[model samples]
Target: MDSSLIQRGRDRGYLHADEVMAAFPHAEDDIASLDEFYLTLEEQGIEIRDEEESDEHPVPETPPSLLGRRLGSHAHRADPDDSLSSVS
Candidate 1:
């Protein structure tokens, strides 16, 4: 497990020590201590950028809900040729 990645998540306030440990169970033994991990982050000059700080575009609007209502009806219909009367 990369302690740096965990530290980054912690700095971003998205994760806590317990959550980090849960994600990387084996890391518990590998990491000397949580305090040490923080100290390392400080030494590395790593900082978490706020979500708003990043350039993000708005999500597109979803399709119309009425499309879902037609799905069942469409599936039950027969083929066009089968629905037509015998011409010969």
Candidate 2:
């Protein structure tokens, strides 16, 4: 599954049926595959809601992962003075 799509679903707490269909084109032809995809989404905490529902919720920024945090610490150590304010 595409991480971006997964993130989108996560941010919204739901995904349009069409979006899910597009993500798993094979599901269109295979009922079993579609069922499995739905199961996967449920496991991931995403819901399949109607597309008519207005998209009012703002997309939340994705936080850095633990690995990213570790790498970021190393980068800061390598350049202790490098900060956003220093970028001119």
Candidate 3:
């Protein structure tokens, strides 16, 4: 089972641990692991929300792009003729 799908389901309030286990019986062990992982994240003060509560939290905005500046920056690559073998 893809953890991301489980996460998305949780995000959308459509899936939970029981549903995941039923859908992917082979992932039983992983369900416990995922629960523990979520717990750890909560312990560290990260917020994990169920679908009902997801709407209450605002999604973070994307950071401004640096691509323009990066593209404008100059860089130099070594020329093949500059190699010691070429000189010799």
Candidate 4:
């Protein structure tokens, strides 16, 4: 297990399960080793995400209603005569 790989994972805040498995192939079939690997990752501040959770669609931190409120607030700053401003 290279420290650089762990550092990169920490910097990105996450690594897919496959990435971890690929980096530490010996841990694959050993349940104890796998658990220790996960703990080490957690200690290093790296989140382990399943490959199914692709980066293409990141989870939104803000809820939709809160997002709407933020956009609405910005809309109020737009010119009253702006055509888009008339939209509800």
TM-scores, one per candidate: 0.26, 0.49, 0.28, 0.52
lDDT of 1 at 38: 57
lDDT of 1 by residue, 1-88 (tens): 4676756665653434454455557665767665565565556665434446433545856567855675756657666777446756
Where model 2 places Cα greater than 4 Å from the true spot, the runs are: 56-88
lDDT of each: 0.56, 0.76, 0.55, 0.76
Give the per-residue lDDT of model 2 (tens digit) for 11-55: 978889888878777765788767876777899999887766745
Model 3 off-target regions past 4 Å? 1-27, 57-88
Write candidate 4's Cα lDDT for 21-71 as tens digits. 787687746778678767888897888888776466766598877877878
Order the candidates by TM-score, highest first: 4, 2, 3, 1
What are the per-residue Cα lDDT tens digits for candidate 3 across 1-88?
A: 3557546655664444444455556555667766765565455454544547644757755555864555454646567668676654
lDDT accuracy of residue 11 in candidate 1: 64
- The local lDDT score (0 to 100) that residue 64 gets in candidate 2 is 67
In model 4, state the lDDT of residue 15.
88
Highest TM-score, which number? Answer: 4
Q: Which stretches of candidate 4 lie over 4 Å from their true place?
A: 28-31, 59-88
Clashing pairs in 3: none
Which candidate, 1 or 2, would have the higher lDDT against the true structure? 2
Candidate 1 residue pairs that clash: none
